[model samples]
Target chain A: MAPIRTAIIGLSSTATTSWASAAHLPYLLSARGRAKYQIVALCNSSVESAKRAIEVFKLPPETKAYGNPQDVADDKDIDLVVVSTRVDVHYETALPSVKAGKQVFVEWPLAHDVAHAKELVDAARVAGGRTLVGNQGREAPPIVKVKQLLEQGSIGKVFSSEVRAFGGTVDREALLPGLKYFTDRAIGGNIVTIGVGHLFDQVQYVIGEFQNIQSQLQLQRPNVLLRDPSTKKVVETVKSNVPDLIIIDGTLAASQIATDGANVLFRFRRGQQFPGDPALSWTINGEKGEIRLQAFGGSSLHAGSYGAPVTIEVHDFASDQVQKSEWSWQSWQEELAIVGRSVGVLYDKFAEGEFEGAPSFETALVRHEQLATVLAGWDEK
Target chain B: MAPIRTAIIGLSSTATTSWASAAHLPYLLSARGRAKYQIVALCNSSVESAKRAIEVFKLPPETKAYGNPQDVADDKDIDLVVVSTRVDVHYETALPSVKAGKQVFVEWPLAHDVAHAKELVDAARVAGGRTLVGNQGREAPPIVKVKQLLEQGSIGKVFSSEVRAFGGTVDREALLPGLKYFTDRAIGGNIVTIGVGHLFDQVQYVIGEFQNIQSQLQLQRPNVLLRDPSTKKVVETVKSNVPDLIIIDGTLAASQIATDGANVLFRFRRGQQFPGDPALSWTINGEKGEIRLQAFGGSSLHAGSYGAPVTIEVHDFASDQVQKSEWSWQSWQEELAIVGRSVGVLYDKFAEGEFEGAPSFETALVRHEQLATVLAGWDEK
Candidate 1:
């Protein structure tokens, strides 16, 4: 099968380095199996930025650069549109692509608000274009193993689940640039919408739907030090209206007629210490056995220092023993080996132009709804 | 120094086997630094049970047996009274000794209700006697190491925490005969009081005070099979009034006067499977590094069965590495080694008859109050 030609919209940090450089370009250039893909175009709000990304990532000389999202979406040769723009632009970028009958893969939050996310979901459904949201953890191998173990009754009927994802502040100046959307409530930039939204998608994707939710959101650090990009000096103070921390407590009602009696306790925080951060830990208890995933990665503040390797601990009751698996990813290749397998499935679906019944977009909207509810509550508080 | 004579107030399953036989007796009898403490008397509600325990544990032939709690409490030769009775009798049996100025070590949930617990705490305070609540996890080595690491700023400023403890049902017949008090609203024997209460004590003891709390409780299993003890036959059905599961999302207000933020997420459930149960999984994320502890023992149903050893994983950013510690009987002994050092100080106090403030009774009552608030909310639901 011919490789699915892809283009990235929104030339952000994740677009320039993380998604385009680390994940998409490499996966597109080297992916094996029936679902090979390639990056053929680059799109950003500015023509100069698009040209820089093309040059920096060494895209093929024939690959085109577009200043507007519609130009890339309207391109006839593009099979997939990857949106790694600011949270506010996700809907604007992906909506055109969905309408153009091209597959869409948007970074987490899917859209800045629930209304926009709902609109994108609706558009994609009507257009019959496949959609994928960047809930990367759900695509990781450890998560796949967890899903398999739950199916095999490794922990019995899962009665409860606890998930936490916490870290210090993101380098806002380096990442956000002219876009202060992360600190702006109007733009839906906050820990709850971005970080928690990403994690909630993985939680529901792995466990099931959350029936009801009661949450507390707090903007822990109101005054953030914004640094000058060139000199790395404190340039100004950015006032953050969005919540830096979010906690939710609720029950997972019986999904598909299986009242497994599960309760969820989740928390996500920012500007907090990253090491020994409990918010990054997760444990799922079932009737047969339990599974735990401990996150111990280093902080980005210290350059590219690696955190602790992800460890999988499984308890087998009948044998009265515990088994463990540990994997190390010192390079992009190793990390890709874990992320590629699952993301590849969605890519294949997108390449075939079969996106009407995809679960990813709906799942992403559910996460956005949860984030909106949390953010709305924060505003009220 | 003369040996501190000890007497048991309840000779039940946990007392006769695990605590008295496996833990206390061997430690008291063979301990190198514990030669000053001797098992002088054994007592239960029934003299027959007391005699059986004495003989089975190979206590001195002159060891007296008593069927009355007051008899054991007032025994002049007894220096320390170990109360391991049902939650109902805890206040009744231990209060007299506490009032008599005898040292006391009572099992968890100091009393059945918050009011009774308060009375005991008040009595112990007025008596000016030393008391120890059997929240042994505080004394566990892994927990001790975590405390040490935190004190050394291993994880930096702790900003958030996630703790999960769940497992399959306890042998309802074997472990819960006295658990009727747990199911009765009047007695406060629900998961909030017993399970979450026990966990809260350990967490608060380690982390500090919880300034406020909000929780959701669920009676997932409304009916349970009541089995006959002797013949192991189905006796009758018992309607459950208390929740088998609980989820709590709250903040432990920064008590350290430090310039940082923190959040805590805790969960407890009954239907969780065993063997591979993440026994007492906890993570504390601070500014410097993250410390994670994964307790590997199964639930109460499968504890100490042929299962994986409980382990603690520590990821110190200062070191840029992860370290793991395993649990074993030897590990328990190492824990005792530290407890033994404290015991040495305790023995000196015993000899001088100079009791330190008995604050545990009050602490237990505070916990009971928290439980009452949770239970009252559960009832309203």
Candidate 2:
């Protein structure tokens, strides 16, 4: 019943731009969040930075500060170890905590690849510790509503689903200076692994798992230009090994909704959404009707960073009518940062012992494996 | 060129429903069409039927009537043969004309199968006669405009394209009385061969051919109930062997527009258009911009029967501007039937010696082979 004492790695205080500062920190600091979670420690690259974050965020003076994952893992007082560092370091930061038998919460893309993710899952299983991966799209308000609609039979047996979306990038032409690492495939934080991965996961959450997949991942833009956000000037140029275009088609495993299994097709391209078009348009065609979800912002629902004014429309064939609705952050959670709203929802669901919205590390591992399958070859059985 | 003395097969006159009556007849009867072609003969199952059609349509008394394809083909005065019969009869009707060394035009699907279509293509090639296949999507004003926009670099270096459209079926639950044959896979006039096949052709015309394709053809609805149009009562139930759902993903072949190649994904389902949503929504993503086309009707641009209120939007990232436009029939062609408009365009292009819009029999043969590839398996390299 006691609050799960938390230690957040990579928590930053210098700027509000980082994911830790923009999303996780805001939610954990909120009044409602404090009732279920208590931030008792801070872990940064250095003890000094951890002290600085504690002081800036105004945490209790008794909160412990640590510089390394080992220090956090060694602490007996912390119940949850949150790995919120750069994607490349996820394995290093979380492996010690998982082995230490502490509940671990890592951001999505659990690691750079499936192999590392599998290791963490294996360790968690052996240690018998609980795990939660930050795949917030499953909890994103719009997606949740769509799942509810499908369950309610607003549409009949789903025959197929299609998604055409724009990958996350405020400026399609160039990356931000510090975010240039997103262009590297090895880092595993690029579009294919993160952007397409999240969308795929959320779609499966709504429909079902893909039975078999065939995908074409293309590095359409090999060279990526990095520009200073404020100056709007090119700061650097990086060779992008990651694919900017992803095309996937497959059959879904049978689910209650699609009893016979459904066909799935997706097209994800790295670019700004067209000026007037939705950044993400997903259509699920069913026997009697259809459900369409359109987001005006880029496809980052998993990261809780999609732009607002999102809509879900249900078209019933028998009546020839369309019901339209929009989703927004809960009024109580609106005080939190925009990108933190869904994370707050995930936390709320976690507190209620619901893993449907905030899935386990094993669930995230399956998605990582699917991504690996996509990258391995065009035909994946 | 004395109006390219022509003979039309299956020119029905009792009802304004058949493709021959709704599309072809009106086009050829128009003033501009009259200047390019003349209907000198009529061919039906028998001379009595052909004579009745001539009388009903008010054809000149001198217009010769023929009982069979052989009779039409043997007439030395006929320089062009237009075969507008049903799918299963296309090969039989068009083969004799091709062998007679007369220019031939056949309704799309050309035949019930790839082998049959190939034979027609081969016969035309060996006989040294000009040939045209009715893939009107290529010439649909909306498609033509989209192609022009792509050529103009309205959307720079293409990265990918996606199409999610509703296949034509006025009633989602049951088929019309005379359309029971549409449920038979062997007939080749079903959703996969006709609906999806036509959409694929138009996309290829706008972008490029699929270098390779992976598709799932599913018979989502097995037993199709046939109903009388007026009564809306089930008259008979037929077992459906054709796939009602089609999902395809592939890479576009290198073209001037898509220099390197682009990813293509399509999802088509047999149903009515979702209310308040575009029946067909297609997006072409490029390096600098994107082009989107939406039709309120069905995905029958190839049959020149897409429901109206179609729009094309070009979004330029640099300017953050969307240029919107709508396509409609030309003023002169407006007097003709709605479905006849695009057919009229094809006729006009053919008269101007332009094969781009009105593709050749060989071109249609390639599409038939692609459909065969989709049906054969999930992977087509």
Candidate 3:
């Protein structure tokens, strides 16, 4: 029962702004994570970058430094490989780890697109590799509470649900230098695929998978300016093909329990939320009641990341009363970085052999395929 | 303009319970309405019923009583005919009035089916008759403000809009004796056609018509109990084929100004609003700002009907400020019944010959056709 040795790819040094540093490191470096997981290696685009990250983050001196995904995959001591890079590089890194029979964890999107995601899923199955996809929504407190309420019939039979949300954290009119590549659709990491995709996964995870979907994706904002944060000067204006607005309506897959194919209506607009309102407003309508989740600052339900505060309420039809739902996270989660709390919960579940409760590569494949269909349909349009 | 002598068909005497009495009589009997309209005749299923209504409502002794629609339509002294009966009778009553070349006003739904609605539209066109459809949403104060703001570019170029609404006033588990017929799909006066239909017209009035629509209509509550209100006793349990849940998403018709084919997502559920929440929540997302309208207590946007209070706010992205919108109604409208405010406005517009500002039979046809398409698709499924 030795701690599982882990190697993290693309673990950046800039803790103030980097996703991997801010979201992943805080949890893995914590006492709870220390007892369950041991950092064995760091992988970057080059050996120098890997060594620099190790030095800047003050990792153990014996931690192996690797220049590429293959080098990390070949490290016999590493029991787990975590792919924490741009979505476009997900398949390149995770596929090698899966083929090498290491437990793999890839940040959501699974890969740049469906074809690559499918290949990784196929590779994992062939190698009999246990895998996890970084869709933290599966462990988010509000999402978990909603799912439990639904299963317990707190709302009776859900007939329909609707979500109106602000989709992106980036300023509507511009972006910062390091984040400018987010405006490019080709990287497969724009708002539609990553930001909205996460929210969509949360919806399906709470209720059920969509049986059929019809969507309209609009490139409402086609040109975006990239500026330097310190100088506050525009460096470049880039053309964007990604859609800033998305409207989807569909029916949930039918279930054995009382005509469970509920209707769904979702709309997401890129940019900040309206001045005084929550960024995310979701309502699940049922025969005997309703459950509403409102996140004030950020629409993406990555727990409290993006500085959003969430409130969950259930309105029971018979009693004509609305009750606030109370949920709790591990005390250690509060000690981790805000963005890393859900990740920490996820890691805890993984350590306790709660694989079924977490989303696997196959789970990621379903979401990835749904998004791929949406994007493909938009391209055809 | 000698008060456009009018004949009202099916003006029920049950002022506290009847739609025509509660919604129409209050306005028509008012001082302002009296100055523009004079009741020349009363039409009902029987001449005795018509006489009873006129007597109970205390109309002038000279008011003629008629047994059928043809009797009112044939009266040369009558210049206007108002049909306020059930949906199934709309075509029968309004058709003869249109063919007789008298201005006609029909409560919304227009007819029981699309073919009947089409015939009425064609008949009105061929007869050169002026017609009004009782869609009061066109004149609701909040709707007026939203429309005005959109026209004035208060929210900039609109990219998308979302509406989540409670679609019916009836209790989810049961219905009253007088309203039991509403559960019958064959009558075509259920939540889908009347409740949700009214809200749909309000959306299209502010934005443009849907260019393409995808909808899922569900009859989640198939067997609803009918009860006697006073005794709280179950009268009957009837099977309902009508949809109690509806989800629609689509793209607006293309416009010349700033790629104006905005995305729309709409969801409506029958029965009461969730406790402590507004029955209707609408958001129009734009480039520079967002406009939100929230109606508490009732979902139907018939001004203050159903005792719902509405608030309209605009969030300017540039200023990051939320501003409440102010709108006004005619002074005389305050004296009418609560549910009759918007109806009073519509009547005022019609009397002023401001036909463009009021919804005509042609306008109702477009809404009816859209709903027809939705119902047809659901039936096919």
The TM-score measured for candidate 2 stands at 0.94
Docking class of 2: medium
TM-score per model over all chains = 0.71, 0.94, 0.96
> lDDT scores for all predictions?
0.64, 0.82, 0.83
List each candidate's DockQ score. Answer: 0.20, 0.58, 0.64
For residues A1-381, could you state the per-residue lDDT of candidate 3 as single tens digits?
A: 788899999897654367788788888999989998999899998888888899999999998899989988888899999898988999998888899999998998888888899999999999987898889987888888898898898887778888878857468777776767677777888888878888988888887888778788888778888888889899999888888887777787665322466777777778877675788989888867889998886887774534756888999877888999987666888898778888888777787775655888889899888877887889997
Better of 1 and 3 by lDDT: 3
TM-score of chain B of each: 0.81, 0.95, 0.96
Worst 10 residues of 3 chain A by lDDT: A252-261
Model 2: colliding residue pairs: none
Q: Alpha carbon lDDT of residue B18, candidate 2?
A: 81
Tens-digit lDDT track of model 3 for B166-233? 74746877887777778787787888888888999998888878777878888777888888888999
Error of 1 at B318 (Å): 4.3
lDDT of 2 by residue, A1-381 (tens): 778899999887776488887888788888888888999999988999899998988899988989999999999999899898989999999999899999898998899998899999999999988888888888788888888888888788788888878865666668988888898778989878878888888998888888778787777778888999899899888898777777777777777788565778777878776676678989888877888888886677766445566788988877778889556668867898778887788777776675644678899999998888888773331
